[model samples]
Target chain A: MVTRGTTTATAGTTRTAEERARRVAADVPDPELPMLTIDDLGILREVHVDGSGHVDVDITPTYSGCPALEAIRADVLTRLDEHGMPDATVHVVLSPPWTTDRISADGIEKLRRHGIAPPGPAGGAHGDGRAPVPLALTVRCPRCGSPDTRELARFGSTACKALWVCGDCAEPFDHLKAL
Target chain B: MSGDTTSERSGWRSAAEPSVERVRSGARPGDVSGLVEYTLRLGDDALILSQRLGEWITRAPQLEEDVALANIALDLLGQARSLLTYAGEAEGAGRDEDALAYWRDERDFRNVLLVERPNGDFAETMARQLWFTSYQYELYDRLRASADPTLAAVAAKAVKEVAYHRDHAAQWVLRLGDGTDESRRRMQGGLAAVAPYVDELFDPDGVTGGLGAVAVDPAALREPSERHVDGVLDRAGLERPPEPAHVARGGRRGLHTEVMGYLLAEMQHLHRSHEGASW
Candidate 1:
């Protein structure tokens, strides 16, 4: 079973085929945002290995009809194939739908480093991935670390991002939307 | 179009992997036909509305609104894909999401008349969205407890989405209604034009009629939908237009307005023109 905060590198158990596969698959960068890996985005739901050594990976999407999921799947396959697992399956899960809260702290750092503002805390503590609360946060500029910024548009180049312009830096950047 | 990700080679099904169903992790619906009919309505509503929303991509009043509306359209398309896939599974018709969306004629569509109504003006579009999103918010909220796991899961995700959409449309309504005299008049006229179609959304039919615990009764959603929409209107200092003398009907029975034919023709044209083509 998969639990929160569990990643391939953190699961320090006896190395199994699944664990090795998980580690390899975890490093596959999100196709849309190459700076972030699947594990970093929190979309890699579960990695399972059957008794016969068949591997299966479950991933969630940032939004429905996110065109990136297919690319991410192919990237996962390519990574797995490179890791010597030629036959693997990728499945998409919708329940406990993907939330910005799932992005790892390290992932958030990576996003900031890559000039993208990370989402604010998961809607608010009581949101529980269900409630409809306004995610009103004062986003800091990823470039100059200035707290002055304004949302240019709610939708960015991709479904998961919102376009924001830094007040101080005057640079337009994408903010991973808090959903 | 050039950098398409998913390959059609994945196909719809594979004999080697029996566990990989279209809607992963969802239990097979109990009453297949009931679920099919019910899901088709949900899917069609989202699908049709998505196509209409897509029309505003570069044509919205503002660039930000263009991006916002496109985002909403993409979200709706995603929801429609999942529901349609589930509908196909329940129907056991071997149809995929694309087939269900592209192949169906206007008369075969089960969407409410509100969504199929053309996007007249900015105010008019917002008015239609206000009503549709409010109703959807209530319907999906109640549907979270559905007997069908697939429907429940879909609703759980959709409930949050429609909330944002509701907020977007509500903001537009408030702005347009309280703005300049000309804007206010336009907003009022938009509400009146869309008022006739509002009644049909809450009218139950064969699909939503008797599904036990699995389906949401359209009639049951009327109060909350009205309350929410009416609250937004009240905030905007606008009154609800009187119900039209002639209520539009027959959407559930696959009877659509003439605009639907033109919409379908445009939506399905490319797919029909080149079968089995991707990207």
Candidate 2:
């Protein structure tokens, strides 16, 4: 019975029912960015199973007003139901708020491979609740592996992304901004 | 941008509706009437400002500024969506966000005077943004610890977004204030024009009273809010405009300037024209 801050079991090990539930819950893809699963984005916060086999999934929205949350909620329930755990309740928690630092290493790789530049670590004074405007230190162009790039707009097609143009490749791309 | 019905624009309706229902209909919680009024005040501020910002989409000085203003507008609209929906639910009336936002007359809006003023120019808009964002940053920062969980949640999320907005406005202020002589003149005029409405932001009225810890008294935020604005002004080589003898007030009491009527008319025109419609 894992609660907050408990680590998940490693791959190739015997998985418990709770672990299996976590796996299914984590596999739900983000509605906007389909290349990365909710697990990859660090949005799938917790999955718990009781002796009665009831599962509770706690997830956080990347943005508070994110319209995609409904889609993500629907998808999470569908995925868990397909895994035979139809009695799943998805709770959206807002406290401790989400940050880009929560995205896993694998998630970064998936984003880069999908031709999107993943966000750098958040650069802000801790405990202030005001994140400094994200300054891209070295946003290497996703199309051409070049370090030369210029930000065009602080926003893009979605709230999570910023528009950038690769100076080397002369190709425009989206850089996922640190939340 | 064509004359399509709401249903014809699935993108518009999906983007417009509140994704989550924060207010559950039961015994309304925590000074229910005051809470409902307080929520409407916040929601109306966001909704009205968003409409003003949306007007800058293709009209900004540059493409980047256009995108930036549009993005800011979208964020405000998102916050408005949640707060308005919650307010409607708390009101115990059948009014949803749409009813409260589009159907209501100008006299019903509860936003502060700063947001309802017309967007005079780019510099004028920045001045309004500077004042409002700084005030919001302080308000939301404290409201994060509200006794009401929903308000706290909204504040926690909104503080992050408004931080960026405050930064954006500050940057523009510095640039325009310290730029060419003509630009500096306009920026200064903009600051003076927006100065009268600044005091009303800190006025503590009945909407915020009697709520205990759930509501933040706007007066308490005065010091820090001014500090933020002063720092930005100092950096931009600007000074606070002298307080006008007569300050505008009464937005909290739903007495807004004549501009509010025109602003609401343009905002609610399509929605009222196409009643009971969904995109």
Candidate 3:
């Protein structure tokens, strides 16, 4: 069977299930934004595996109304099961709510390459006696690389995205909204 | 709107009747101090308003508006789901979010009258949204400090969403309210229509009194809520509609407007029809 992670010797064990399980879980693509993996999207919060191979994964949804959260959870489990993991459970945690800034640089590049505009920095600090105020950033066209994009709609097909039209290219695209 | 049914007049009905009884409460068990009641009030507000906003899906004036409104609706629905689920668990009742949402009768709903108000027109929708979200922004901002961790967490997430929504609604109020005379008149009329129902939102009685910091005092929110609305109105060049002589109240105690029945009928019909069905 194909292993999910690099087999590294740890203590007395050849390779730990936790490390393999995490890689398997992280490789599951986001159902909504398929170009990004759960790890890239920063929703996969925690993963743990016991000696017997029972696994627990923690995830957070980018938006409270995000319908893809369940799908994402299922995809994680299904991928784990397919990768030889049997006992696994996904738990959703809401604290320290997901913000767009959590999206990795690779994920941002992936989104740009996929024709969806990545989000700007959500806020400066988290839980620092501040909430995210509306921060207007100049959105550039992912295709033509023009900064003259105008938002066509504040809401898009998904809760965490917005519809925008690039002024220069005249192409409409999905923008991951900064939460 | 003035307390058309003001006197907290024993609005409780026997959950004994009907098809939706499967969505029944455990005879208000474990809810004596009204934490469940408090939680349900917030949840029902989101649920009912979300339902109203969803009606604009295809009918909105513009395609962009349709998406915007629906997105807002979904945000509220998400908040409702969390709050309702929390309420169910706290009440120690078996009811889940769906059961609470799809099973309650009109009188059983603890949502304020403002939300259940008809979606009169695009301008009216904007007006109601501005007032509600302005109030909600302030409420959720303060609610983050709630002693109840779940409520606090829900508020922490929701405060950000409603901030976006509140800004969206305020911009519309400014746009339509300050536009053409025709647009201005309609926006003003919309404000007037929703004015009477605004009072019920800040009613401080019922569940909140005993709940301490776990519950936000509606009284504490009134000043800030109005200040925000008034500031928006000032920028929009729109006059604040005079307070209606009759302020609608009693929703906190479960007495709702006449339209609530129709709204509930539409919302609860499918679930009540297929009692235990799930996809």
Candidate 4:
């Protein structure tokens, strides 16, 4: 049987199921929402290998209806098959739910680099100073180096993003909300 | 032996706590059908609107706006898939997403007429989005507490997405209404065009009435939906059009506008041609 960190017997080194799954998932980028990784989004839930060497991967959807899911599943299967686990099954799970909190810190940084602000902490930050306006706040522009930005819309290209425009650069960017 | 062990453990656990047993026992087959129909209505609304938005993909005035419309459409499609899948399973219909989506005729669809209307222009699209998403957000918020676990789960997830959609439409409504004279005029016209169809969404139907305990009453959703829409229109400096004199219905019973048949034909053509085919 294959282990978590080691490669299979036929391979060079033995790898654990989680490690194998993570390695395979590393290649499956978020299809539509490209800034984040499947791992980063917490969609890559679990990977396991049976005694027969058949691999099973579990994934959850970011949103119930995102069409990119089919493409992601295909990518996962293709990547894993290339990695030597030829018999692989990708299962979709819906329990425990996917939350914005699952987004990794590194993913947030990557999103910022792409010009989209990472979701802010849930229930705005606490400050002793008078309660801040719930709506208006400084959002750094993704395209131009400008803080003079206004929220154009709370919804952006996808449900995951909000629309914001920078007055200085006259560019509109998508802001990824903190789930 | 493993199965026996798991079942024994569950039985012992249930004996120790009667609440779990009560919940299981309370579940009836008819309740499942009710839940299925209720979920189908929600799915139909999302699916139809998503298709309408998809029409704007290449035609949007600006490139960025084009991407924006496609993204919204994707989100709606996602919700539709989940709702339909859940409904299928609950009903024991042996239908999957593809079957529900491509197999159904126009008359079988339960979406509101507003969603299936043609996308006239950017303003018209925004007007529909603003009105529909506002109503959806409110409906899903209340549905979060539905007696059916699956419905509640779908609502809990969709509520967040619809909230963003509502906010997106709200901003555009404000911009167009408060912008130049031309923009304001288009916004007002768009509003007038879509206003007539809003009443049909909240009207009660037989399935909804039968599914009352497990599902949300459409009539109950009307008040909050109206309040939310009115608030947005008021803030946008727009007038609410008078409710239409005669409201159209029958979507739940599969009767739809002429446009629905064309939309369905395009969506289902390939699937019907090659039965059970997959990419």
Candidate 4 per-residue lDDT, tens place, B64-126, comes to 677777877887887887777766665565677678899987767888888988898788888
State which candidate, 1 or 3, has the greater TM-score. Answer: 1
Could you give candidate 1's per-residue lDDT for residues A41-136 as a string of tens digits? Answer: 898867877655677887777787788988888898888988888889987766665678899999999999999998887644324424554564
Q: Measured with DockQ on alpha carbons, how good is candidate 3?
A: 0.26
True contacts kept of 4: 0.26
Which pairs, if any, clash in model 2? B6-B279
Where in model 2 is the C-alpha error above 4 Å?
Answer: A1-25, A46-59, A74-92, A123-126, A144-148, A166-170, B1-30
Minimal lDDT window, size 10, model 3 chain B: B6-15
- Candidate 2 positional error at B152, Å: 1.0
Considering chain A alone, report the TM-score of candidate 2 relative to the true chain A. 0.87
Q: Is 3 or 4 the stronger prediction by DockQ?
A: 3
Candidate 2 chain A lowest-lDDT run of ten: A5-14
Model 1: residues with Cα > 4 Å off, grouped in runs: A1-15, A123-131, B1-30
Docking quality tier of model 2 = incorrect
* Model 2: residue B99 alpha-carbon error in angstroms: 3.0
lDDT of 3 at A56: 75
Best-matching candidate per TM-score: 1
User: Which lDDT tens digits does candidate 2 get at residues B75-166?
Assistant: 89878976787677667676788889999997899999899888998999999999999999889989888876667777877788887789
For residues A62-123, what per-residue lDDT tens digits would candidate 2 score against the true structure? 76557687788889889989989898877665655678888999999999998899998774
